[model samples]
Target: MTRTSQVVVIGGGQSGLAAGYHLRRLGLDFVILDAQTTAGGAWQHTWDSLHLFSPAAYSSLPGRLMPPQAGQEYPDAQHVVEYLADYEKRYELPIERPVRVLGVHRDGGLLRVETDSGPWRARAVISATGTWWRPFLPAVPGRGDFGGRQLHTVDYRSPKCFTGRRVIVVGGGNSGAQIAADLAHDPEVTWVTQRPPRYLDDEVDGRALFDAATARRRALDAGRTDTGGVASLGDIVAVPSVREARDRGLLKASPMFTRLVPGGVEWADGTRAVADAVIWCTGFRPALSHLAPLQLRGRRGRIATAGTRAADEPRLHLLGYGDWTGPASATLIGAGRPARDAAREIADVLA
Candidate 1:
């Protein structure tokens, strides 16, 4: 069976929820197709120890402010999950769950969202599926030969699993730092990075990163010289746990290994170390496979966009992917503006 709506949202995460809020406010009919069985989106899948980089007040959706978690400054993954569940309830967003979207194909006057459940036709389709489902592991030589366990950020649940084992944590981003720190006390962990990890000052957090991103966006809009945003601020934010781990000398990073051997990994200088497991916190690519039918992606593997609207496919809007769709759009606090913009544009086109 085929359903029809004025707009169809491809995700029910922070970004998708934000779009739903704006679309509802605009009095537009829409449905949010979520692949997950329940709420919380990607937060439900994150490692148990994961915490937001900013305080609750600094991290919130468009309509509701996330209430402070008692006895905690930065909220954990569960807190985020609860908040999202509550947000969806509060707004009464029309979200369909466990509906895996197959692809989006252009119809004569609308877009057909093909999903496992059925097809939905919409005048405008907002693709808000974020990247957590698509973990990106860099290609390393002899990776297949490694007899030990290998997992990506998406597969990691807790450091307890690696307890008492020799583990190698790869990547230099926030996940890498956090996972390595989480494992350091209990396990023999070697944090490997392509380059030395650059950490933001203890005082800096997600709030500052959002501010910098906003400033950069403004400067670019005014045709002024670029203000290096988050990149200028450094890669890792010294969260409390990470800071404590660093001070205790547990977060020390080593140069990236040259290749994976059956016993372990070897560096360019032929230094070898044995590890029982290798955890890759290498990050993710945008989960855009469902959008493949549109053929809007460019040579860079990204869909060109004018604001949130796809450059080639005007009926399609991309949301919550990252800076390309909007400044800081991937974060809870940053998804609002882009979502609002996309909703208003869709409303205008439909009207």
Candidate 2:
């Protein structure tokens, strides 16, 4: 069946919902196509004990404030999932689930969104698919030869299963740090990072980190050369569990290993450590496979975007792909601006 709309938002996650909110406010005829059968986007797949670095107030989408969980300091993944589901229900956003978009191709004056269900002809398409689907694992020598189990963060559920096992957690990002901390109480776990892990002060959490990033962005936009007090968000925040782990001296990270050997990893100094399993905390690439038909990806495999709109394709906008799409678009709080702006642009064009 062929369907049509003034705008077709290609995801039903936080970013897509934010954009839909604005589009509805503008009275635009639109639909949101979500690949997942349920709500919550990638938060559904995160580890069992995963919690947001920021508190509920700082981690909310536009229009509605995420309510704080009773007696909980930091909202966990399940809390986020329930909130997302409730948000969709509260706003009455038009969402089509389990409709996996296969590809997007230009169709004369309109854009054709080819999906498993059918093709959607839209005046504009918003590609809000986030990075969860595209997990990135760096190629290490003898990776295939390693007889032990290896799993990326996407497949990770809990550290309970890894009891009494020696595991190597690779990457220095928040996920790496959090996962390492989660496993600290269990069997031996080693964290490997290319550089030393920067531990932010106790008071500084995701909110402070985001504020610093916003300041730096503003400074750069104003063409200022000096950003003295700005700190990168790459540093690990002192979350409660992480802080506890640090107190236990379990937050110590080691230098990255050279290659994967049978049953374990080999370091640069010609030393090998035997391991029962390896958990790759490596991050993800943007989930842009469906957009490949557009041929818009530039250097570093990212789409060349002007604000949220595609630089080459004016009728297309991308959201929640990280800083490249818009500052903090990947976060719950940050996605609103870009989404609002994208919807406005699309509405203007359709007008």
> What would the per-residue lDDT of candidate 2 be over residues 149-244, giving only the tens digit for each residue?
999999888988898899999988888999999998764888999899887888876677666656665676789963633245446777898989
Give the C-alpha miss distance for residue 257 in model 2, angstroms.
0.9
- Deviation in Å, model 1, residue 151 alpha carbon: 0.3
Off by over 4 Å in 2: 226-234
TM-score each candidate.
0.99, 0.96
Per-residue lDDT tens digits of candidate 1, residues 1-351?
Answer: 999999999999999999999999999999999999999999999988999999999999998999999989999999999999999999999999999999999999999999999999999999999999888888999999999999998888887787688999999999999999888796478999989999999999999999999999889989999999899999999998899999998789999999999999999999999999999999889999999999888976899999999999999999988898999999998999999999999999889
Clashing pairs in 1: none
Strongest candidate by lDDT: 1
TM-score of 2: 0.96
- At residue 81, candidate 1 shows an lDDT of 93
